[model samples]
Target: MSSVPEDRFRRSPVPLITHGARRTVLRADDGVRVEALYEPSPGGGTAGPAIVVAHGFTGSLDRPAVRRAAQVFRQYAAVITFSFRGHGGSGGRSTVGDREVLDLAAAVRWARSLGHGKVATVGFSMGGSVAVRHAALYGDGSGSAHGGRTEANTAAHADAVAAVSAPARWYYRGTAPMRRLHWVVTRPAGRLVGRVGLRTRIHPRDWDPVPLPPVEAAARLGTTPLLVVHGDRDPYFPLDHPRMLAGAAGDRGELWIEPGMGHAENAAAETLLTRIGAWLVAA
Candidate 1:
């Protein structure tokens, strides 16, 4: 499955901010395809830390918000923003956050292959959950449609991460929308979709898959500071998700809530990046 030709995200004016090698990282995940844009470090002075940005659901690599964040990160280290499999240049169906997590691992490996050792991961929405899951544990092969183990795929990261930013944590599942989607995928009347062997009830649908919860994922980190940012008015994850994560991690993580903004608002909300950028100062 190649990337859908039409992407709705608007391109940001990043030329004024970042200057580097403009290329693409066309990669695959266990024969399933995934890819990212490669902007090599400005390659001078002290480019100590590298970063890889992940996009949210239904979002392509060039999503407007991601490009803007990539532009912001370009000033610090190498920036690689990629599309999950089934979204852009990559192949396969979008597995919501489950399979997407593997895509992030692939991107991280690509960054490391470029000689970037100390890395920082930034993910938004579904991407955020993937980042947290990968940081906490190694490959579990949730990518398989058959739910088999990919144990041979060992952890690639050094665990010396700078920081992890998960803007919105869609933790709860009993919410109105999720319940409806769950019913759509599980109800006997919804058997038509099942006949095609399609299952829309993903982890985000009132269920979480990782062995470690988001808080455990953050606290599981040794020294790498984790930043948990969420919008109080977020309609998707609701308001309490980040609070729960920060509360769970205690000193292991930091939480910030954006008032009056809802889900996906962190990407487009006013002064959103400023706060996120400030919170990202390598701890």
Candidate 2:
């Protein structure tokens, strides 16, 4: 796990084994190059379930926290981890949670291309919003949301989806963390900080037409099993966010409110991730 230059691997489409995973660059439907890692399950078969993991904003697939989650998930299924556009070795600037759906879509499609029969998407925080939106728009195989049954849409489908510590709506500035996050995405100085300090590249433009919120997206999941997990002690969005999502999903989704958990992948306990992996397998 020695640190190497990211430039050496960022643009290469060819797969190479690195740090115990198959690392490669995938071309997103929008032409953004997404850095990804594919790790087989312990049993070493591609026919079983596969999990595509989407890390939160400012989080990369190579981050220790994200990698840890992938490792734990691999116990139940093969895991595909990727950096969202503008994160890590990926190309393009982040539109925060808006256009990130395309990034998740690309990863999910790549998962199926790897020969995994069943695919589950697990996203944390900002990535959670992308997962929910991706599932609603493409998980049913119709891909009607993106206009038609294109390859990207077909590949974007997931059998199951899990969103952790995600917000229900956009432009929510109630919490201090969220307020600061908005500043990070909206201001030039903050964007510089994001690029230099966080190593996350952010797009300058705002959402042209606000994409569907997570709650609305949750309602459209259509038979795709959904799991909404949040922590009561979360510093960002509170229990109401998960409640709104779960409520919109109705019986199609299940909500787990962890007692002491704070937020996203960083705060997720090992037991919780293991349980989520089991849920993915059973769902």
User: Number of the top candidate by TM-score?
Assistant: 2
Model 1: lDDT to the true structure: 0.56
lDDT of 1 at 156: 40
How many backbone clashes does every candidate have? 3, 0
Candidate 2, residue 73: Cα displacement in angstroms equals 0.4
Best by lDDT: 2
lDDT of 1 at 105: 77
Candidate 2, 1-283: lDDT as tens digits: 1112234334534333334568889887678999998998878588899999999999898876777788788889999999999999999999888878888888888888889879999999999999999999897677776678876688779999999999999999998888888898999999999999888899999898999999999999989999999998888897899999999998999999999888888788779999999999889
Point out where model 2 deviates above 4 Å: 1-20
For 1-283, candidate 1 gives per-residue lDDT tens digits of 0022223334434552345544565544556667667775565322455677777655666555667667666656667788876565667765566666667777777766676656667777667777776665542323322234453233244232222234223434656645554454445664344324332222213234533455556555555566677765555565566766666555767777767655541334436654554445354
